[model samples]
Target: MSSAPKNEIFTQVVLEVFKVGGLLNIDGDKLTKEFGLTASRWKILGAIMLSDNPVTVPEIGRYMGQSRQAVQRLVDVMAKDGLLTMTENPNHKRAKYIQMTTKAVDIYKQLDMKQVKWAEGLSSDLSTSEMESALKVLKHIAKQISA
Candidate 1:
């Protein structure tokens, strides 16, 4: 690709990604609110559930590209809300590992079903090939930017 055209495409992709992110956040908030959760809270719960083992607040912050203090405060609230529980981490004395409660597991299952339905409806007009291409491009851009 020519430099000018490539730059223009990059700019357009960046703008579109930002717009998509905003829209997803809006959708997330609406979807999660039905279950007494916000996007952020839901996301934190997902992080713990998705992990193979219990994760620390700092580890979650890194995974979510957020600050440790911010994640810590959110985790505390979630713990208080009975959505998460903290356990002693053998690796770190001060940094406790966070685990999801049974209630959280049930909620996440419901959320996952909702997400599947929402995604299927939203992508009804798009072909699998197109979705794969978009995913590839987005992953490439994410790696580049993160690096």
Candidate 2:
């Protein structure tokens, strides 16, 4: 309850969050490697998949909490690889909307399956309530950090 102890606890929690982020990055790359996706590519794909409609690169960037330029470069490479296609945006003239190709959708599905298995294995020792509690804490921290 003392200020110093509270500060130490906050510092420790922040350090743990950073540690978890680094580990998750490595895990994400490893899990997506077989699907020819890196963590970045997989993340963009996920953003697109979760979008309500085909979205512009800027929108994707916003959704992913990344820069538009970074998302645009990734979109260009993905388009070249035939994972997605850019179409003229009805809402915006210069900015085009991105949509996944069938190939991309199939790949996403495979990735989702892999994620399910990977998560199950990782959470095998943790109870559902524990996982939920952790999720809540993380989400709260994320909201605070963003704010």
Candidate 3:
């Protein structure tokens, strides 16, 4: 691609990312509204669940590109809701390690099933190779943009 077209495509990609992000949030809200959860909360659950070991609010915040205070606030609420539990962080006095409660694990599993089916339907028309290529490009762009 020439410089001109490349720049245009990049700009379009960024705009599309924003558009798709909003739509995803809307769909997520609709999907989890019955459980009184939002997309951001769902994301935190996902991050903690996907971690190899228990994670801290700060770590989850960084993973999700959010603020520690925000993650902590959400964690507090989740804990009260029985969706998560916090234990003392051996490595840090203040930063507690967060883990999902059994309730959260069950919900996460259900959500994962729904997400897989939703994603499959959304990507039905797209080829695997093309989707993978787009993912590669998006990752590259995100890295560059974050840096």
Compared with the true structure, all predictions reach lDDT values of 0.90, 0.90, 0.90
Cα lDDT over the full model 1: 0.90
lDDT of 1 by residue, 24-143 (tens): 989999999988888888889888888887799998997887899999998899889999999999999999989989998899999999999999999999999999999999889878
> Residue 79 error for model 3, in Å?
1.2
Clashing residue pairs in candidate 2 (N, C-alpha, C atoms within 3 angstroms): none
Give the number of the best model, judged by TM-score.
Answer: 3
Question: Residue by residue across 65-107, what tens digits does model 3's lDDT show?
Answer: 8999999999999999999998998899999899998888898
Model 3 TM: 0.92
- RMSD (Å) of each candidate, 1 decimal: 1.9, 2.2, 1.7
Instruction: Supply candidate 1's per-residue lDDT for 13.
Output: 86
Model 2 scores worst on lDDT over the 10 consecutive residues at: 1-10
Off by over 4 Å in 3: 1-5
lDDT of 3 at 2: 62
Worst 10 residues of 1 by lDDT: 1-10
Candidate 1 vs candidate 2: the TM-score winner is: 1
TM-score of each: 0.91, 0.87, 0.92
Clashes of each: 0, 0, 0
Between prediction 1 and prediction 3, which has the larger TM-score?
3
